[model samples]
Each structure stands twice: as structure tokens, then as C-alpha cells.
Target: MTKHNNLQSISVRIAVKTPAVSRALEEIVSTLDGFEQQLDEKATQTDVLVLEVGDNPAKEFETVRALLEDGVVNQVFLTSAKTTTDILLPALRTGAKQFFQQPLVFQEVQQAFVDIHKERIAGEGIAVEKVSIKPGKMVSVLGAKGGVGTTTVAVNLAVSLNRLYPEKTIALVDMNRVLGEVTVFLDLQTEFNWDELVKNISRLDPAYLAKALIQSAPGLYVMPAPNSIESGSQVSSQVMKQVLETTKNSFDFVIVDAGTQVGASAFRIFSSSDTIALITTLSLPCIINVKRLLGTMRLLGSIPMNNINIIANRFEKKSAISLEDTEKMTGHSVYSTLPNDYQKTLEAINTGKPLVDVAKNSQLVKSLNKLAESLIVKEEPVVKRKSWFW
Candidate 1:
């Protein structure tokens, strides 16, 4: 396939509000690569598709909503006649990258074509493999014991990522349905829970996924557990995998709050995460479990030795084990030790607000910020393989 001047190549569906708009946009987009047709969505691989949805604004909105929900269309071009601010807002609200108020601009048309050409050129220049995560990074945060404050770390860490990477997407998944109060901690309304999402698992798209996770910030999304346990999802590893795979494609990061019983789905998520943060304190048995989990992961090759980082939560200077001693005992460096700010953390928890918002500069919040930075900016360094003889 000699790739050039063919928008149908990439499969990014560009939908317009009307038939005329669709026809007009097609005339413009066909000149570019990877732009596919709305009809061909199922038949062909549409990296980007252009559609003129003027045929039915309401239906168009619904269709567009579903597309964005499913993370199908990479980029969108909105066109309407004397369009109201209301018309364009919905598309933009759902993350349509570029919108056109007036009919196809000769300059924008030219520019859009130019941009596509440049992307193709740049594609050749870079040798990076496309690592596609549906919504974001799915980092499974589980507790060693019941009261290890796993949800606390998960929610704040997610909030931190939202603040730090306001440009990228991050999701905090409360896997602990019964007791998982991530929503309560963040003070977000638990109107829609895991069941609603699981119901639409087949069509779990970006637009839908975005709505599923409460938008705590522009970049961060939170998928809280159900309010009442009367009829929630019996989420298995497969279900979690499907949701996670869809999330990986749409967002840059996904933080999972694994409440207890790291079995089935929980185990799978941890095994395949970019990073696995084991939140444990100085309790001897908890520490032992953390160590044992690490050893088990290494033995099973479920998690690489390097990707596992231990986080000592509610830490204080007066702790019995020094940082060095903790490291020695665990045989792993303590990534970040979050201080025990009882009043501060509790207040934030009670109010359902992030410490960053309530107690912004607190030591514990600062430590979480540092940890967030470490995850976002730090890249894996090359390591040498151990020789058999050694």
C-alpha cells in the first residue's frame, strides 16, 4: 500500500452534522491519509473517520457521543450553518480536538491536509512503538491488610496525577466495591457506579468511560464503587481486563484501588500495570505480606523486579524502622514515605476533598506529589542481565 493523500488509511472517522457537510468534508479529507467513512467503521480499520452529521443533530450528537465514548474517532471536525454556541460546546465538551463554525475553510482545509501530511512524515521519523491504553495507565493499588489506608493513597495519588498531568488522562478505580469509599473521600456524588459501566461493557468507549469516571480535574477521572451493594457487578478478572483494556486506549493512566482479596481481576491488573504500588506500614505482618507478595510476583514473573515500588503510608520520623532499615528488611527501596497527618487527612476525607485542595502544602500531600512526579517523568533505565556464572 503506497500511503499518500488517502485519509481512509488511518481510520479516524470525521463526522459532520449533515449530509452536505459530510460530503463537503469528505471532498476535503479524502486528500489526507487515514480518514475513513462512517459506513466503513465496522468493515475497515478507521484510524480517523470524517462524518457530516447534519442529517440529524440530535442523532448526530448521540452517534458522536457513542463514538467518543468508544474511543473510535481520534480527531473530529464540527461544521454547522450559523451554529449556536450550544451546538459546538457539546462536541468540544466530549473532546473533539478541532471544530469549524463556518463551512469548510479554504485555509483550514489546506492546513488540515498539511497537518496530516506532517504527521505521516513524523511517523516515519520516530521508531517508537504505539503503546495504546484505552483510557489511562491502570496501576493496581491494593492493601496488605484491611486498614492499611489503600483507598486513601489511591484517591490522593489519582488527584495528584490529575493536578500534575492536567494534559493527560488518569483514572482512580475503586475495586473494593463494598467498602471502597473513593467517592466519599473525594466528596463526589456516587450517582453512577460500577454496575452502570459493567452493563455497557460491550460499548465501553472513551466518551462513556469519561462519564463513568467522575472528572475530578481536566486530566484525572475517578471510577468509584457502588453506593449500595444490593445489585453491583460481580467483576471478574476478565471484566476488569476488558474495562482496563478499553481505559488504556483512551487515557494515559489508570489507578486501581484494590480493597481486598487480590484474586481474579485484581491479580491480573497488578501483573500487567506500568507500576504496582504496595501500600503498607511498619506492621511486621503487613511488611511480611508485602515482601511475600513481591517474592511471589518475581517467582511467577507476574511483575518485573524493577517495576515493584513499596510505599510506606502514614509514615513519621519517629517510626521504629528507619528508612534504611525498612529498605534492608524489604530488599526494596522505599519509593516515598507519606507522613501521618491525622487531622489533615481526616478532614479531607470527611469533606471528600483532596489534601492538595484542602491541605495543599502538607508534608503528606507533598510526598504524594513527589511520588506522582516520579511516576510521570521517570523512564526506565537500561539494565544489564545477570550472567549465569555470577
Candidate 2:
């Protein structure tokens, strides 16, 4: 019921048989920020309950599960001197968020309490009703073939959105399993990657997600690909679906650099996206690939035809194939075009900066910015009603 530093106070109830573990838990809970110890033995409900195993371990586990299922306690932490599989597995299955041995480790207890505090804080944010903010929009950029500037468009568009809408939350995700260039494009050094999200799919709450994403200089949050092929291989389409679903509620816009990947996984990405920025050049092979990809999407019948937006990268008037010709070949009109600034784009990549930052006045940056603007949905203004007194 009390508040500490603007955070609601967390009430902790400790029920431990061991004298040493009881004392340690008391100390740890006392030291935790925004946490208060509930000494009332008769209290049935609390924010967090720390329970130690008793002689009848099975009965105790049942009681703990019931308490959680009935919403009597928000979270439960179990402790036991026995580290056997029977004890540990039951404790985990009983819905305990953390477990400590009889001889508790101070640092581990402290870290567990810290994680709980973060989750509680994030939970408060979620409890508040959504007013002006709605679910986020996702835009996935994919190249018809290699070297079509897919990453370039994704990175610069995200940066431009961050610049244009400073208050809105933006996320840039690299969906490539190996050798993804999203971080290199933005010059970002990420501590976490999409692999973490897949491994901790059950913990895909706001608190965990915030920790897994790193914010770049432009204020856009980025989730890079795995560092190695093995880690990338562990990510599955179902897990990526969960990640995207969780992120949609947390940000205003999510930009994905879906580097040339095909199959069920790639299909999931394209289907989940609100707009699929299919990037290609005027080359014949690229056009043919585009036509094939379109047919694949059409056959799958997951994404709408209009949702696929064809973008011509490095467009030049003298190119072998014109935009109209390419459209006729692919059965889709060109949605947008980026001017060919080979030298400028190269310098931007070499410097690890977005085209917008490298040359704001250049045609490439202008085109990218315009592309970013088209994806944003403008909210209608609310009309004020006249007061009776007025």
C-alpha cells in the first residue's frame, strides 16, 4: 500500500524453517529497493512469498501452486537444502520464479530480488490503460537478391523515423540468421541479440524485452542477429512469431531487415508485417526473382497483394529495364525508388552511418525519409465539446 521513489512498495512474506536461511532472506528483502517485509503471520495474501520446503514437500508444492493459481500471491520463491531432481523439478513445476538453497548465496538472492523489482515496475506500466498509443506497425524489408541495399533501406528508414518522431518508440530487428549487416550499417555494438528472445520466450514481458534491445544514437532500439550460425539456427519461426507479437505491443514501429531468406520462416516474417518492402534493382535476374517470390506469396495466400511494396534501389533513367517494364514483368507497380548514389552510399556504409546522417541533402536520404513517412498512420484529432456553463 506504501510507495517508495514513485514505485509501489512490494510486500514480502518469508516462511522458512532453517534459522540461517530465514535470517538471510530477511536481510536480502530488507536491502531490496521498494520492498517491505511483512511480519504478520496471519496474512494470507502478499506480493511475494518466500517459502522453504517442509517435511511433506509434495503437499507444500501443492499449497504453493494453489496460492498462485488463486491469485493469493503474485510470485513465489522456493528454497530447500535438498538439490535433488525430485525436489528441484517439483519446485519449478509449482510456478516458482526463483529457488535458493538452504545456504543461500547473497549475490544470487540480491539479483533475483532485483529482477523481480524490474518485472513489478514493468507490470505497473502495462496495467495502465492504453489511450493515444495503439499496437505498433511492422515493416519488413527484403532484397530480391544480394546487394540490392535491403539493409540500407531498413536502417535508414528506422533512423529517419526516430528523427521525425522523437517521442515514438521504434525497434529495428535483423532477422538474418548469419552475417547480418544491420549493426554494421548503424555502427551499433549490441550486447544482446534475437537469440536471447527465442531462448527466453516464456519471459517475453516488457522487462525482459527492454533488457534484450539496445538503443542506438538516433534513439531507435535494435535487436541484432546472432553472433554465429549455430545460435541463429536455434531460432525457429514459432519463436520469431512470439517475439514479433510481444514487440508489437511495446513500440510504435518495428523495422525488420529480413535479408534474403526463403521458406517457412521467411514466410512468417512477410505475413506478420504490415508492409513488405521488397527491394530490387532493374536487372533481369532480379526482376525474375521478384516475379517468383510474388508467385510464392500468392500461392501461400498469407499476405495481401497490396501489402507487398516493390522498391527499386539505385534507380537510374538509363538502366536496361524501366520501372514500367519491371512492373509489367512482376505484376506489381513500383511503390518507390531510391536514387543511385553509389559513392555516397558506399561512404555511408564505410563510416557506419545511415544515409540520412551522411548526406541529409542528397536524393538518397530524401527518398528514404519519404519512404519512412508513408508507413506512418496519422491519428485523427479529437474535437472538444462545449461546456454547459459556456
Best-fitting candidate, scored by lDDT:
2
RMSD of each: 10.0, 11.0
lDDT of 1 by residue, 212-293 (tens): 5666666666777776665444666787777777666666667888876566666687776778778888778788887777
lDDT for model 1 comes to 0.67
Clashes of 2: 0
**For residue 192, what is the lDDT in candidate 1?**
61
**What does candidate 2's lDDT look like per residue over 1-390, in tens digits?**
123477778899988988988999999888767899998878878999999997899999999999999999998989899866567656756777776765777776776777677667677774432334345789999999988988988999999998987766788999988788888987877556888667767867554565567778545888889888899876788889889877776777889999888768889988889899999999999999999999999998999989999999999999989999999999999999999999999999999988877798998888888999886655642222211000
Candidate 2: residue 211 lDDT (0-100):
52
Evaluated at residue 172, the lDDT of candidate 2 is 93
Cα-based TM-score, every candidate: 0.63, 0.69
Number of the top candidate by TM-score? Answer: 2
- How much lDDT does each candidate structure score? 0.67, 0.82
